[model samples]
Target: NAGVTQTPKFRVLKTGQSMTLLCAQDMNHEYMYWYRQDPGMGLRLIHYSVGEGTTAKGEVPDGYNVSRLKKQNFLLGLESAAPSQTSVYFCASSYYLLDTQLRKLFFGSGTQLSVL
Candidate 1:
């Protein structure tokens, strides 16, 4: 029962509208990330946080913002939604593995957003 959960699996927005997508986890992960999946771009990172109260921009952070106010939750917000922002948003969390020297991510089902 402990995993990532994203609310409002789908949404439709008008131009200039705004909304926030919530991502929560009970796994006590140290790192959390927000990514957008496009037709052929794969998953491009929008933002991420290493720990609570810290955030950083990732590959594509222009039209989106993210925050990690709690260790178990990460929020992605759109100030003014645009058509170009329509895509499948995903949330992931992971902890560093000493043996593998890599972080394994657990992702949410994803929220599909469309702007018209």
Candidate 2:
């Protein structure tokens, strides 16, 4: 079973172009997240969902939107891509974080997005 997978592993966009990155997992976990990693920096959360039908904003959600319509998939959309939004996007999931072994976050390789 795939833990977490991100689509459009690499992408290039003109400033103001729109794109949506897809994330999917088959683990049936209750938590999923979107994070972007700028070069040489730590991952910053963009959006997250604790379970299906519920989405929440995170540290950097300004240029992105997310949805979790099913238990297995989460999507991150950039309505208008910008040079500053150019970064590697990673999606993660786990059963829990507060008190569980599976609390260890699992990450996708990430989508390398570039905006010109």
Candidate 3:
């Protein structure tokens, strides 16, 4: 069963800290995404890349960064951690965007993060 997987299922960071979350997939998908789920804000996209060697900001791209150098891997980086940034980070992969022609997505369990 090849699908999306996230590294360090849990993490804790102090204010103004830094960290990098890794996401890998084995489906040879062409699209990858990073999102943060808050208490009531639902799932907001932080960044997404349509294919290798390209990346773009999403609905809530501020305070976060992402890179997609390899088609199978996407990385989310936090330069300075903040309390507000403490939320579940999810790594997702899809052969195609459900809303954009291709459908269905596989999501990893999640990364629970805490910031102080």
Candidate 4:
């Protein structure tokens, strides 16, 4: 999509292997987030960035790392892939509306990752 794009729509990784998920947004949003979708846990935040060069941990930051070197790009890295890490990952960007005191998120198509 034009708003957000995630590379490698699907992937299969072996235990102990490493990989990185790339997220790019063209909307010029102020906030970017990385989330993983599990069966019953729903969407769990992995990491987020409020702006360029700023990164923060979220609900589930363990086993993952993130970096926001540019305003339009956010990267999620897994040093060691595991079965528990297998899930559908989503990248989203949002912009705040001062007048309405609200924000809207634009999500990527999602990446399906399987750790064997």
State the lDDT at 114 in candidate 3: 94
Question: What would the TM-score be for candidate 3 when compared with the true structure?
Answer: 0.93
What lDDT would each prediction earn against the true structure? 0.95, 0.92, 0.91, 0.95
Q: 1-116 in candidate 1: lDDT tens per residue?
A: 86999977999999999999999999999999999999989999999999999999999999888889899999999999999999999999999888888988999999999999
lDDT, model 1, position 78: 96
Model 3: how far residue 27 lies from native, Å: 0.3
TM-score of 1: 0.96
For model 4 the local lDDT of residue 94 reads 97
Q: What is the C-alpha lDDT profile of model 4 across 14-105, one tens digit per residue? A: 99999999999998898999999999888989999999999999999999999999999999999999999999999999998989979888
User: Which candidate has the top score in lDDT?
Assistant: 4
Model 3, residue 54: distance off in Å is 0.6
Off by over 4 Å in 4: none
Candidate achieving higher lDDT, 1 or 4? 4
Task: Give the winner by lDDT: 2 or 4.
Answer: 4
Compare candidates 1 and 3 on lDDT and give the better one. 1
- Looking at model 1, which ten-residue stretch has the lowest summed lDDT? 1-10
Residue-wise C-alpha lDDT for candidate 2, range 1-116, written one tens digit per residue: 77899998999999999999999988888899999998688989999999999999999999899999999899999999889998999999888756554576888879999999
In angstroms, how far off is 76's CA in candidate 3?
Answer: 0.1
